[model samples]
Target: MSAAPFGFFGKIIEIDLTGGDARVLPLDTALVADYLGGRGLATRLFYDAVDPQCDPLGPDNVVVIAASPLIGTTAPTSARGHMVFKSPLTGVIGTSNSGGGWGHTFKSAGYDALVIKGKADSPVWIDIAPGKIEVLPAHHLWGQDIHATNDELTSGFEAGSRPRALCIGPGGENLVLYAVVGNDKNRVYGRCGGGAVWGSKNLKAIRVQGKEKIQIHDKERYQSGYDQALYLLRQAPVTKRLMRELGTAGLVELINVINMLPHRNFQDCTHRPEDLERMSGETIAKTILEKAAGCYLCPIGCQRHTRIDGDDGSTQRGEGPEYETVVLMGPDCGIYDLAAITTANYRCNELGIDTISFGGTVACAMELGERGLLGAEKEGGLDLRFGAAAELEKLAVDTAHRRGAGALLAEGSYRLAERCGRADLSMTVKKLELPAYDPRASFTQALGYMTSPSGACHLRGGYAVSLAFFGGTKEIPRFSLLQSPIAIRNMQNTGILQDSLGVCRFTGYAFGSDPWSRMLTGVTGMDFSVFRLEEIENRVASLERLFNVEAGATAADDALPPRFAETPIVVAGEEKMVSEQAQERMRRDYYSVRGWDSEGRPTRALLEDLAIAPRAGRAS
Candidate 1:
């Protein structure tokens, strides 16, 4: 095959940790064109390399680090990076995305993705600088937290260098299933056991730095599109001002206004006005937020830098308790103390655990306790009660150590609740805990969650909650069930395009596929039209569904937990629940659109049409 195109170096670095061998392989540019990049290409690569029957934590499970065509480009929010692996937590194909300097830095090292297979015989880490790869022993660094690990890896390097690292903490060392692989000590491959996978491999971190120049086919046109995207970024209400000024935490109040903010284990979606204010972005801004940070190529500084005093009187400094963390730890767990939430968020980051999973698990345990399930001696004299900010604080640390009740909590809400005989109280889908958005309140978002490839997730399916909470092409009525299926499918396709291109979702608010098409065509000289990108999205979505099916998932696994489908989260006089009838309608329409069978498996004809049937086994 000929060398890859301008925007893509078309290289994949495959490391076999079990045998301590590394190979630099040529990536298929045709596959790049078909899948686009990032999540799409990564999933395709994973399908080829993974065994559907392999345990997610076993040596057979494959992990791919996906660097998109847009990485290191001037494309707005193009700093995002992605990983595709089988999740130990959800027991499905795992796709995790994050933004920081890692993608750009690694791309600069002149490789497209890192495909790691097998396990290291012992704790190890890799340092990849331009033209060099060193596998070093990490036994001494094994137990360190994310921050400490980052510090250890970069200690000898000069200040303000371009090296980026992804590391796990004690959570991973001990195999917390919800462990995270943190990039830059803050932004993380935060969902679906990315860290647990790393732990399983006895791999601690991957640090890279490079200065290789990235080429663009049409620099002038690429610049123009980049400029247009930047202009639109400035014009967006959420991106330009709100996100830049208040960080993602700014969204806490907006979600609260819509009454979609989950509180007290989602038993109530709405909170008292005062309680809402207490956890509001404005409150965080005025109280603990020290600054707003941004990712590479992103003008919107929605990342937060926060600090607060701990009970021990020591200062705790950390990057966000982002909107999800704030609510999941605060309102969802019924802890309204901003400082407490911030502190807990700090500890979670250091421990390399997912805040969403960590806090949501605690919230579920709290509800179990409230329902008299804890029976007093709930492991280590635990006071698993809602509104206990102190316990919430302790929970993060204990969960990291997997101490007592923490061991049960570490299994995630689905298994934990099953053992507790309170599975009805667990708010999750396909085993992954839900995000801050309540499905009952955001009807379309709920539909997206049900069929999301990575289980009950917000981003992987689509962040349709955005269209309803804020303004969009037109106002979307939250209650209109009929508008949801098609709308969610379209949004999910758009999401795939965004993730495939390695751009931040925040910038997705400002522009559409037209500008993205411009970036793709101008840089790589591909015939990347808006229509073609949509097909690529459909192709990617179907491929992921097929992977899940090959792993034994069916329509029965596609429904929401009983909490959202059965119990109504009361709000103002309205008995609100995601009607089961509406959900069935949405699923049928979604499957029809994608040519999927009732079993949620992709049809042979549809696979052939997408031209992914052959590789529905190696691609970009």
Candidate 2:
């Protein structure tokens, strides 16, 4: 306890904007033992800082930025950072993660996490450098997009030792609920309104730069674990070839082949072969791709660098329209033009908005327009029809700047549906829009979305589509109502472990429990095993559930949207829905496994067994 943990710098900082003060605090070793790092420790800190009574957009809401233990080292794909906050979008306990270079630098600055609170009197940004911390005026940077902000911040800074700025765009400045906090001008903590939270605090950005070597406790053991992880990454076909070579967009046609690709706002789950081909990763690579980009310590390099000719004869370049962004923005909106999707993706990153939410909500408006319910000439002169590339591009900007119908569209899909009196048309759970995968086509995927803390989130819900579409490591039935819950739980645990460790989720594809355990034990000098890691993952999830329950969650919140219950995907003339009976069974099975009541709240005994107790801020 006296010396720093092998993988940590043994420092945590809390900043209060209202008072313009900051403090470094000590984290308990036992607490660190229970909830390793990344999202786990951040979740615990969130509960300690904010309760159900806290207003999400107000100063009372807590913003926790934490790093995983494996960061700042030779660990593969280890540069990850997590943010846990009260979601201004979903009105629940929320979290988002990013990996570029921020975490490693932050750790090098000798801190494990940063908790931000209160609000600045004016626009400001925090500077974190080795042995230095200060809040500086950002009045001029207030209205700029993330790209411009990045350029301005790094303008005169030393290129060799430049600080990495994580900032928001005009979307956040306008309080667009789904605004993103972007890192390195492209990589973002994209979901659950992380940018809006920053905007609320009058915080424009955070810049981190540092120089420190991360010490390895056991060199031989760490090398052995590191080598195993590297070997797995090289050997895994999906990670090395499919993701590294083709990028995530390669899965577009693969999902289409399985009849699980969401098209036209979930009205159809598959597209015509030609359209699917046009929107696939191969098409992007052939047309406008410049290169593949990788995060810190990552081997796969799944990020695609694309550039397409702009309307004025210039070229627009951006990082990625990952599979989720491509499918949600392309097929979901019925726009198969890859260039158009690329432009929309570019606009999203530039403006700091969640492309999934923005595209999905716009697609909902498209369906509403088709039904004559909305989007008329009187409705802000908006063309909410499907497949209008120009309109789509315009709307992306409008949403970020809160222009025209973009103002309404910024409310996100669930609230937009409520305003239009058509929540049934919205493909969402817990008010957050669904990702690219249609749950009706994949039962396990459906369960994950329904029960996810962030509401219909695919990644937070464990991306069960790996087993459902691509053959994953575990062999589980994609459609069996009986067996999918087990796999979903396993996937969720794996996600928790990865998130907690601050490594890329793709690591799960390459290495399983053994590699992860070896990495943690070797780097941190902790006794790690598959069994111990699962326990920690479960404890983390249980604590999150406890946070939500205290935040007024119920079993009803664990259910899907009304559309998923009634409307079924007619794929190849086979009507398929997750079904009321199957969904009920999955919920029951998952609850039984979690030792929770039917309402998804962890029982007292379960918390006791996990050594988790409700904190002082937990709501009565």
* Model 1 lDDT, residue 547, Cα: 86
Q: Report the lDDT tens digits of candidate 1 across residue range 1-620.
A: 66786888888889999988888989988888889889988988888888877899999989998888878787878877889999998888889999888888889998898999999999999989877887889988998999999988877877766488888998887788889988887999899988889899999999998877678898777787888898998898988889867777777877777778998888877677787787677888888888887988778888888888666888878888788998998899988888788888888899988999888898988888888886533765544888888776667777888887777788888777787777877788888989998888877888888999998889997787665546666867666677777788888888888889999888778888888888888898878889989889999999999888888788877788877877887644688887678788788877887789876788888888888855432442
lDDT of 2 by residue, 105-168 (tens): 8888888889999999999999887678898999999999999998887668766677788999
For candidate 2, which ten residues in a row score worst on lDDT?
374-383
- Give candidate 2's error at residue 184 in angstroms: 0.6
Model 1: per-residue Cα lDDT at residue 11: 88
Give me the runs in candidate 1 sitting further than 4 Å from their true place.
159-161, 311-313, 375-377, 380-383, 468-473, 571-573, 615-620
The TM-score obtained by model 1 is 0.96
Error of 2 at 103 (Å): 1.0
